[model samples]
Target: MASDAPAGEVSLLDSYSPDRPPVTAMRIDFSKTPLAPHYSPYFAMVIDSLLTPAECAAVIASAGSNWRDLKKGDSWRECEQILSVSPDWAKALSERLAPHLPDEIKVLKKGDVLSEHIAGPSNLRASQGTSKTVWRLRGADERLSFLRYRPGHHFKPHCDALYSPGDKEKSFLTCQIYLSDMPEGQQGGEGSGGETRFWPSRTGMGRQSKKSGGVEEDEQHTENESFLNIEPKIGRALVFQQRMLWHSGQEVKRGEKFTVRLDLMYNHHFEKPSK
Candidate 1:
């Protein structure tokens, strides 16, 4: 895979326009905070017009059929609409844009969720000259998959990790490439509810307080944590250290919300042992 862009070209303060959103700096000061040791200064970017209108529409249509609905008051119960586009389309788009997608697109079903997808050639190509400087750290021979969400569907706050014993440490980075236009009439205001939010990890509260002060502690943690709520933009992708961050998809209250999320994770080729 290619390396990151040069320092001068990858500005932490510089902003892009029209096709790209203005770049913003995230606070790297983790020392003074009370967060868990895993917390890191993760980075992300938003790029507009990543795909053509026809491509976006095709992906959205495919996703619309696979949506799984959720019930009210559920913690992390949300509906997900998914579709594994043809390999040709996947490769074409990946080649033209995200070269990091795997050559094979695997369609997942109930009870078959895995940690991450391998980055394809398209992914590597897009990262070649980008600001985020860690794309080359990805492993080779990894698989890649895309996730979709529709209106009224919400993925509650949760970290993307292996729920099983052996596979927990294999997950590396959680990358999401936004595949739809941020609808104008959504929730937060004009472009409201379809925001993707990342909550800071919570750590160090007394063990006794953990059970007895559950609600209170959660509220307190929420207040102390720093978060990034990104507005959707076609072709824009965000990558972050998974184990160190807690993230979720905010509800899609208004307008049609469609997003194609991809994950780049480690496989058996992982170099270091899991902590």
Candidate 2:
């Protein structure tokens, strides 16, 4: 059963502290599917309370600076107007600011920064042989995109763009931070219905193929029995590999939803694992 701690408190990963027992946010058993056809059960988790309300508010304000009419892949540039969400954002502020902030407000300024590893389970960390507490990993993240979904807006079913088969610096995972949901005590976007849906295997989750070959998913599998629907909540983040997961963003029925989508890149070689 879900807890009622707050409007958007994450009950699972946040329960353990890093000091007393060194609890980790990454979980290996959040979702499993050996026959997923394309993805590995390697890591996919929805972490709650990763960000504070104040931090989310800052992100909301940051994204509001410039909201592009979200576009599909380049192959369907002509149909770019079809997507109802905001395209992307200006820049990633956390990586650029995390080093200078104090301990108290540091987490708020860099929630997504910590998210890089928290979303990626396994002892393999966001660092390479560093005893320091805040070691930025060598790879796994390159770009951070801010997605805004307003009333009647949404993304169709589709997976992320695949790298050049074996590009050492390709994006292998997609990380999303749910910046806003409902009202949450009068501090967020309005309306509702911005849930994310995913299909287990090659099910397509009942959605229709929109683009010819560039990977622009549409929301068409409304009645499919083989998909799972995940609702958006403030300060929650969803991470998964796009190589195998077929997903779509549900249309906002009433208000708006803000999400920070970061492209987790990959690097084959590393100095060594963190100590």
Candidate 3:
């Protein structure tokens, strides 16, 4: 979790190769968009066709043979494919998404004395030299993680951890781009079980009411409460606040599931500059 770049500056993808192909950006109107059915928005939304079918195919092929299996007990499991791409991918995405994102992502001052009850102790820090109450998207993380889930592969309910480097920068949002749909003619057709589902926070401070003993008891927790499910669709990107949302990659029972995950980094600044 290194600082990608200074605020308002572009980060060079140092770990990525510069030979990767370019990605196209889509214009979306997220204003007035509501969270799926009943959950609060929490800066979460889906953008369909963010990448073309050809682009998705190309991205999948780019992974080549780098696929590696990751399993940490029963809580997490997936096949990961890592790709190093030029900074253009993150630059284009950050630019297109900036206008739609909130103006200021808040962060506390570096030495501010706050109680332990604060939700994000690490995220509340300000820049090293100045009092910072605002943060802005610096760039996308260059290390792209392309995940593949075969039938029966799944991740249990969990919240995405933040990537904070030093006191100046951190990752606040995640962009999960679906690369391929379930193969045709499966049990429930293309969009069957491989879904990025979201549950309301269990601490009673979030949108929906708190629920207990559900996720811990049942691994998938499909029977406990109504959740927002974003099915696998080629080129669809699910972007949400990483800290506030509790999500899981439901078990894939049909065909293979392909997705590219990107972390969007934000950097705190000393002052709120005039727009």
TM-score of every candidate: 0.52, 0.55, 0.67
For model 2, the superposed segments whose C-alpha errors exceed 4 Å read 1-42, 71-142, 163-167, 183-191, 203-214, 217-222, 270-275
Q: Specify the highest-lDDT model's number.
A: 3
Query: Global lDDT of each model?
Result: 0.42, 0.48, 0.59
lDDT of 3 by residue, 112-223 (tens): 3321111255554434454445555676776566788888888766666566756767777788889898765545455558888776554443232122112222333547
**What shift in Å separates residue 206 of candidate 1 from its native position after superposition?**
15
lDDT of 2 at 24: 23
Q: Which residue runs does candidate 3 get wrong by more than 4 Å?
A: 1-41, 83-88, 92-131, 184-191, 204-222, 272-275
Sort by TM-score, top down from the best: 3, 2, 1
- State how far residue 110 of model 1 sits from its true place (Å): 35
Q: What lDDT score goes with residue 120 in model 1?
A: 23
Candidate 2 has a TM-score of 0.55
Q: How many clashing pairs per prediction, in order?
A: 20, 13, 2
Summarize candidate 2's per-residue lDDT along 46-145 as a digit string, tens digits.
6666655566776555433544565445422211111112212212323422232224211111133333333233222334444312322232342345
List, residue by residue over 14-95, the lDDT tens digit for candidate 1.
1223444333323233344443344433333344445555555654454335345433233433655343533333343334
